[model samples]
Target chain A: MIPLGYYIGLSAILFTIGVVGVLTLRNAIVIFMSVELMLNSVNLSLIAFSAYSGNPAGQILVFFVIAVAAAESAVGLAIIIALFRNKLTVNIDEVNILKW
Target chain B: MNLEQIAFLILAVAAIASAILMITRRNPVTSALFLVFNFFIIAVLYLFLRAQFIAIIQITVYAGAIMVLFLFVIMLLNLGDDKLLKWKLNSAKTISVLLGIALLVEVSYFVLHFTSTEGMSPNAESIGTVESIGKVLYLNYLFPFEVTSVLLLAAIVGAIFLAKKKFE
Candidate 1:
């Protein structure tokens, strides 16, 4: 029998790596990918805890999360494309038209 | 310490490495490819956990549909090497590192203290199978599940509005 800690620890490590990617990467596309990674890590943790607790609720939640994540990526990439077209760059620093 | 564990370790390492490469690669196409590879590895991990339905959904929704959408946008944007926006190491890196360390420390403490060391009863029956999951979802969480579909519709409309060309 595998321990829940093992799964949770793995999820934590993956989540940290994703958080780092979101922080350090400047490319908008890469940041989008990092967000997906973070969502996947959450799915892992949810599934692990669901297995631990013997409840299907968490798994259902994971399903909802997956749906939302897919939709989010679609919208995020679309917005990125629009921004890149108008500004000719996806770099966060140079395209700051909203800076107050 | 068995084959399953060994396979999972390899898949996890591959996934993490591909994810790192995805962030660092200069070519957007290459980065997207690496992201796809990473998703496949994650699907393998889900399979190892005996969540076959989720594994397939991971591949279909994330790797298949979402990535294709990303690639479509990348191509549509026709983004090339823009010298104006180069990625550089910044002061934010320090803050992120510190934050990551703090999160790791907190998770470790929780893992060590809050949770018992008890192993879950290996669910020999179908815990994550599609049929069982669908039954439970439709029966108990039916309303929320339907609401989630509505949320997807809202997101689609929102995305279309955000991407529409503006006329002056």
Candidate 2:
């Protein structure tokens, strides 16, 4: 069996990549994708721990996470589409009237 | 390294590469496609972890359902051209990258330090089976499972309301 550290490290790296993407990428859609990436990394860690601890709880948790992610994606993408409809752009920087 | 180790290495590399590609692509469609590829690789990783049910869910739900929604929105918005997109090679970008690397280092250090070398549980195989999972899910976690259905309903209604062209 591979060391548990490997999976955790991989998840960390992926999570960081997702964070960087969210930070740097300006497109709302890509930002949403980055969010999904982070969520997936969390899933990886959950399953990793679940397998190592011989517990199915983590697996069940991941199932809920996936369900939540599905709901989030549907709602989030709709919001993006609505924002696109009104603002005519999905570039996040441009949507920052709230920032000022 | 054994065959399993080798397989893990390959999958890890592929997953990282695709994630990077997904994040960096200028075209949203391309990024979505790379994300799909990354999901497939992660599903294989889940399989290796003995989470057979989660692996299938990752494929069907994430790669199948969610990605299709993403692709649909991308195409509907006609966002193909990104020439005038707001991205630039500047200070904010550089600092975010540095912070991300710093976080990666911190997490990896903690993981290596804290993780026990004791690997896979002997009973991991049995617990990961669909029947065992269903037993626990239905008997123990029944309430939360039902809650997800309600949550899904709310999301569907909310999405339709938000996406509609105008209110009557």
Candidate 3:
């Protein structure tokens, strides 16, 4: 049996990548995709802990998280579409209308 | 180590590498594709953890459904590379990358040094099966399960409302 630390470490690295993507990337869709990556990494750690503890609750929570992520991405993408329709661009840096 | 450890290492490497590639790709479509690959690897990792139900859900919901939505948005927007290239490496980006690396190092330190006294239940192997998950989900988690349906419905309505052509 592998130590639980390995999974946790992997999850942490993935999460950091997501954070860097969100921080540095300007494409709105890519940013959203990075957010999804972050969520998936969190789910990984949750399942790892659940398995390590022999508790099903973490897995159940992952189920809820997945459902929420689906809903969030649907709504988020729709909002992005609306923004694109109004601004003619999906780049976050260019979409700033409230700056002034 | 054994097969499980080896599988974990391979899947973990694949997942992390794909994620980095996904973030660094210039094209949104390519990035989304890499994200799909990352999701699939994570699903396989779930299988390694014996969470078969979550593994399947991760594949179907994340890799399949969510990625399709992302691709559709990417195609619909049709953003040009010139527009995406507006942002360059600035101070904020450098600091963010530094912070991210620091966070990773700190978390790894904790994870590597931490110890737990609780032992896994002997029946841990069976907990991840569909039947077992279904029991806990429907019995103890019935309320949250129903709430999830409601949330999905709300999201659907909200999305349609947002994306619909303004009739003004």
* Candidate 1 displacement at residue A7 in angstroms: 1.5
When summed lDDT is taken over every stretch of 10 residues in candidate 1 chain B, the lowest stretch is B79-88
Tens digits of lDDT, candidate 1, B50-75: 67788899899999998898888777
lDDT of 2 by residue, A1-100 (tens): 7998899988998999999999999999999999999999999999999999998999999999999999999999999998988888998878987885
Q: In model 2, which regions exceed 4 Å deviation?
A: B165-168
Query: Candidate 3: where are CA atoms >4 Å away?
Result: B116-120, B165-168
Q: Give the lowest summed-lDDT range of ten residues in model 2 chain A.
A: A91-100
lDDT of 2 at A59: 98
Q: Per-residue lDDT for B34-56 in model 3, tens only?
A: 99999989988888788999999
Interface RMSD of 2: 1.2
Q: Is candidate 2 or candidate 3 better by DockQ?
A: 2
TM-score of each: 0.90, 0.97, 0.94
Q: Against the true structure, what is model 3's DockQ?
A: 0.72
What is the descending DockQ order? Answer: 2, 3, 1
Error of 1 at A16 (Å): 1.1
Q: Rank candidates, TM-score, best first.
A: 2, 3, 1
Candidate 2 residue pairs in clash (backbone atoms < 3 Å): none
